[model samples]
Target chain A: MSIPGIRDRKIEDVGLQAGVDRLTEDQIQKTIKKVLKGETGAKLKLYAETCMRCGLCAEGCHYYMSHDKDPSYAPVSKVRQTMWEILRHNGKVSPEFIYGCAQIAYTECNMCKRCAHYCPLGIDIGYIISVVRRICHKLGVVPLYIQDTAHSHSATMNQMWVKDDEWPDALQWQEDEARDEIPNLRIPLEVEGADIFYSVIGPEPKFRTQLIYQAAVLMNETGQSWTMPATPGWDNSDMAMYTGDYEVMGRIKRAHFDTAMRLKVKRIVMGECGHAFRSIYDMGNRWLGWKMHPVRVMHAIEFYHELLEKGQLKIAKTFDTPVTLHDPCNIIRGRGLMDQAREVVKAFCPNFVEMTPNREHNYCCCAGGGVINCGPPFKNVRVEGNKVKAEQLIRTGVPVVIAPCHNCHGGLEDIIHAYKTGQELKFLIDIIYECMEKPDAVE
Target chain B: MNAAYEFVVGPLAWIAGAIFVLGSIYRLVSMYALAVKKDYSSLPYMDLKYSLRSIIHWLNPFGTAGWKASPWTAAVTFIFHICLIITPLFLLGHAVLLETFHGIEWPTISDGLADGLTMLVIAGCIFFIIRRATVDKLKYITSGMDWFVIFLVLATFLTGFAAYHQWLNYQFILILHILAGEAMLASIPFTRLSHMIFWVFIRGYMGSEFGKVRHAKDW
Candidate 1:
């Protein structure tokens, strides 16, 4: 049942409701205070005092634009509704308020960091929302699906429930599939000292096995020294960071870094996953009180660009389709790989068109930052809230859009399908694989 | 000078100065200590190059994505902040007062230029009011205190302009202008106006995160 009008479409979420039911008033209040006093420092204090509520960040937010310029959807207003809400209540958090926070933080925001960039003061509303999610996580009032994924990160060390044996099996299956084309390809697993420890998100093994297959083919054709671990830490992607389970988040990062260290690899090369790269490079490292990665890390965009630069990965055919590039927020805005990604696209896709606000200035797919992991209940809200993105894609006037990140593909696919823009999305690798020269395959 | 004028011009000035300087220093030191205590990792990435780059870009009008997003706000904000900061320091009247009171003097702007800057600040404040009233985002985010802060700033410039022009009761307006300026100074470390001091730290932290950690330009 939707509790509309009073609280603005408070949809029933079992995870949130159950989590709230399990908590007492005392527990909720104490949890909030604990997180506030222990976890936060001057950054929170400065943001709180410095915010003039100027609302200039509103124009940069897709949710604000898509929501018919609704005042509440403004980035600062979202902060007011969640973080400021907690402050106003002074830690006496109610079930209903916590519910609103979970929805707004987990579903309403993609945490794209666009608003942070758009803020004249460089105030990170995404970081503010993460603190809210952190409080909600402690209160045990998290949205169900993402919390489930976080639990998967906790228990199995992977987001999917793939067991000990399934990881290597999935890699083997992808290798066998790729071997059909390359005829001498191998997805080497658990090599002791490969230069690149190629890691990926959980979805690859469960369903998007083709991404793994293509990455393996790229590795094989380039004659690269890379390996996929058979162990639990092979999944570099994490949902725990989004779920606000910092302990689990820290553990996940540790496991990933340790796996690479144990394998004695020179670097950890991640698949086309933005959030995972963010986890390893930016967010997760800081959680462990470190400024640099334990091992060097590379995203697929950088890896491919390196290969192309070295003439290792040769382009066999230029893609004929009129393609446009969707710069994912994590890599482009968060990590700054816009020029490299565009270079790779220019190398392969001859008929490439640029979006209006290309590179770091591009809008986020509503499905990122674990908003998509919040699951089917909030899909409409996610789809409806990114009309600006749909319009952005449509304005490119290209049938094929290339997204180099996994979460971007997930979010853009939904937006395209919902808007029925008749646009198709592909990974940069998909086009790269289609157009690049393979070892032994003939057209 | 009359008693009321003397009090504002004498003891009140010293009190406001003491509070502004001491309070701002206290806030800065306390904030730094807090960061070191709980967020030590955040401090490690405080790259001077990145922080300077970020601060310089933000200080430039329309240099940031946020500024360029709405050119009108950027224009008003840059004009307002620049005039608000400049007119007080560079005005011939201020320079004369410093020379008279403390045997200190610096380069000063001509009265005509000072008049223009003061007017720009007042106009910028009016522009902000209209924006808050019209724009839904600004309207929702703004509170009663926010409105008061803007009006407080506006009053300082308006009274100074009125005093300079001798619009009505020159002595009273001049005293009012001095008091308003004092109040704004005192409010800096106490209210939303504290952004003046916090901007350095915040910009530096964000720059470090983007440039040193994420290898991106925040601007």
Candidate 2:
């Protein structure tokens, strides 16, 4: 049941090359049957049985809309192409079929769950797509870059393969960088029983080390007791969860929680990352058999909101440039931080204008859900799929786009370049750093 | 009564009704019985009040926040469901049938209103069928069962309309109408139409998940 021309687009990436080797038909069938029987439950059955194919979900999907209303891109069509085939064949499908499922589940869909909101039946299409990814993961068929990232998670306990020495070195380096601004500043490393255990994704240390400096300055300015682990658990990002490797997901989450518990922190305050927030607060915790995180988890938005509300962080000047906010889907839709995020933005930027279809209804930056982790090989697909988003940003006519999530920042960076929108993407913290009054300077 | 009428309008009617009730209950119970992991996350936003309010809010197609996302579909669907339910329950002929079978009667709508409502239902079915056939995205996802359900509802309404006007071979048309109605009743729990009962649980669970667990205002 190979889709014509679909295989032609396959990229030659190391992870894809290593992982997606042809499997025996029997192996494929057995794996599919096992997952379908074990993973799927009442909700899956109800969603499958109840969808009326009304196509209302089509309007909600940015991919479908962006792709000229391509039928194959529709959320329900994605389900029919992947999950229904498994059900219809009773898992007797071919390796070719599994490959196609991997592509759709991993590459095409962001698993943002916006379609679930528009569904009259409230079918969580994202969950269904993730189930397909799980099956693909079992079949050893996942996107190259993301699977490689997952391998990093398995080996290094982080996505970027940041080693023990590198983690501490990067922190120390950032601490020195921050001290240039505030002479007495320090990026506290593993201060046990700190009120806040601040974790960040791997990229902060690897490529975006400046973000760590900004966070340090903000923390010092606020006089908040926050310590970052000089270990693997500092990377809150999880590509394994997106790739449907739940075992690796659970392990990564366990290490993260274990790190927090070891530090005896009262709560974990994560940097501005949407999927990481979803992973810690929702998916990863649930996978580890805890109904919730053992320690309270707060996104940077919530933390910022609290700081502002408590008058701990005061804005010395409002951002002069007219700026627009990009609501990261995981935080806005996955958690209800829409109002809080806007309030924080308004505190710094008085000239804040909203993008059309803002908040929970906002379009995904199309980079989260590990799509960006699919990496450079799938760059064109990622950029093309986010045509709607590019248009949405272009419509705002604002120079700067405040994308709070790490992945959204990456995705929007690509979109801005590809679409030639001339829009600069900044994190909320970027503006906060610029506008907040320095505590040492005030005296 | 003729044997044909007796079989369809009498004993078969009771069988359909029984299947409709018991089958629907079985489906609902089995679905709810499916193991669900409890969400132990502390509520950031507790709004059981708004969760219930959202159920009613979503029912009003124009009123909900999602209306902006898919306005036309929402409007058409809202109207279609309203006409579909009202025409069957409050039609003069259906009231008479209910009184004859179960010795129960409710106020009936005027024949003119019932006729207009029936026409609206027919139009809705046609719109659905055409949309499934013509909308590229919809056409791909639509299964035989999807079209079959639409055809089945159309048949019921068409035959009932024909039987009401006494258009050619009244008895035969009436029998076809009853059989079509019975088929719809028997299939409700098994088909996509089961959303009628499942909608409560689905929408309620989603509302609670968003409103309480995730702490998002979905509406």
Candidate 3:
């Protein structure tokens, strides 16, 4: 039996609902108008017109190489197909163009901004793609599951429809479970005026709550002043941002920042996430019209570096397993945190091998940039699109892979399993806490 | 000069220039038609406030305006591209042509700059090709057409520099040089290379549309 047949065996394979899946030419034009209207505002014009396609960006893209060197896979070409065509034709392009734009913006590409590293002109192709996604979202042509996740972001302030009470309850539950590893661990919720506000996405409450517990254990053991919110603002992850639902994205970002402000924290120390960091640092903060983020946001990698650098967190034992780091584009390329992450890894693990072209030039997990969340129908493209990443992992010859960002971790897992890389993937926080001494175990 | 060389170099140059102009006009006109049909409007100035504020971004050491999207890659790639463009146009043979036609002589660079630029272009191309081959998502986007273009460029640059060195010591090397340069010009309008010129207009139009959408202008 073929791979599709095997996949079909796992689920009832009703194909995509026909007719409704495609948009009409007239509808596409209408969507273009609506998108233009919605996207109309201050600060977007600079974003729209700044691209210079030197193709220096070819180096940062995974899809471009993954799909047999299709120029359409290049981030610049993706923009060309949608925004460039719109400019060339002045918006008379068909709905099919919009459909293509939807796929390129939402599914085909991950808005990782790694290409930005190669672009001499520094055209934020990822930003341009996200804008295209925002337009597609307003046009009502986004893939169903991703759009549904965005709806959850709007309604519940979380992507998984996790309620407010469930958020705190999940964190408390994780704290309880962590006590087995280290006795008397407390995952404090809603503490006011804390120095650090640790924010996580909805998955912690919905599926991986133990991560929240792990984070709590690490935070407390490091003796950091941190707190998790007990309200709708707890989730810093924004699927709405990925799905191009700008209005909802604005809401989520606003709530997140407001919650941080309400707590009067020095900065937001986010859990292991890439898109969420991109949202807070790159997208969401900009949507709120701030020149710089009102609340300083740090990924878990940055926070860990800070803790270790200040000698606030001490590693009692070095993790003995050989490991490779999957550089999260947002943290590495966007924020220049790759060196810091490596420093943290070196402090925790005795055996660490750098992936080829690690740091700013790292390959995307192929699932990120909104590709993984696009829906199951596109899974074939997502998995097959990352064969090169699998090959890279195979070459590393390491048993453990540390992916700091949640989205990258999820996406990497899918690719690893699909290609059977036979490696265990863990969050940076997981390994950090595991290797650190308990508060009482200190010398 | 022999009439054949004159015809090939002069009239061919004219034809290449004409084709380049005509092809560019056609692409721009078609693009404009599409934008107009879509009611594409130039973004108002207020929307591009950041782009406006950073006027010197384009003139920076590494094309800072473009690099705002990506600083590190932009710096290195920009430097390499500069060498790629400058080395070809400023080669000794190119200087001879300019001295013959335009009556101007640029100060000759030490062989260091010449060889350095050649190596830079080679390295840049190699880096790009390796990236296209190694990265998964990028591999998906790497089509045969793109590879052909890059490979042709690599061959052109490599062979041109080799011919300059007179390594092969063959008349065919000069012919190859002229042929590659002419072929690159001819291919520009039809291939993705058209993106070089079209992107400006497209970017402007996109900036304007985003302005209209964002209710601001000047991006």
> By lDDT, who's the top model here?
1
lDDT of 2 by residue, B156-211 (tens): 99999998899999999999999999999999998888888887766766777776
Tell me the lDDT of model 3 at A139.
66
Once superposed on the true structure, which residue ranges of model 2 sit more than 4 Å away at CA? A1-20, A441-443, B36-51
What is the per-residue lDDT of model 3 for residues A161-268, given as tens digits with 9 covering 90 to 100?
Answer: 997677777877787777777676677777888999999888877888768877887887877888888888988888888887777888999999999999889989
Tens digit of lDDT per residue, candidate 1, span B1-219?
A: 589888997899999999999999999999889999977867777888899888998887778888888888898898889898999999998888889889997889999999999999999999988988888777766777788899999999999999999999999999999999999999999998999988987988898788876677676
lDDT of 1 by residue, A1-443 (tens): 11222167787889999988887767778888899899888888788778988888888889988989888888898888778767766678677778888888899888898887788887888989999999989888888899899999999999998888998888888878777788888988889899999999999999999999989889988899988788989988889999889899999999999899889999999989999988998889888867778799999999999999999999989998899999888998888899999999999988999997888789999889999999988888889999999999999899999998888899999999989989988998898888898867633
Report the lDDT of model 1 for residue B51.
Answer: 90
Please provide TM-scores, in order, for all candidate models, with all chains considered together.
0.97, 0.95, 0.68
Ranking by lDDT: 1, 2, 3
Better of 1 and 2 by DockQ: 1
The alpha-carbon lDDT assigned to residue B3 of candidate 2 equals 96
| Segments of candidate 1 deviating more than 4 angstroms | A1-6
- The per-model DockQ list reads 0.73, 0.50, 0.07
RMSD of 3: 9.9
Per model, the share of native interface contacts recovered reads 0.76, 0.50, 0.03
Predicted chain A of model 2: TM-score relative to the true chain A?
Answer: 0.97
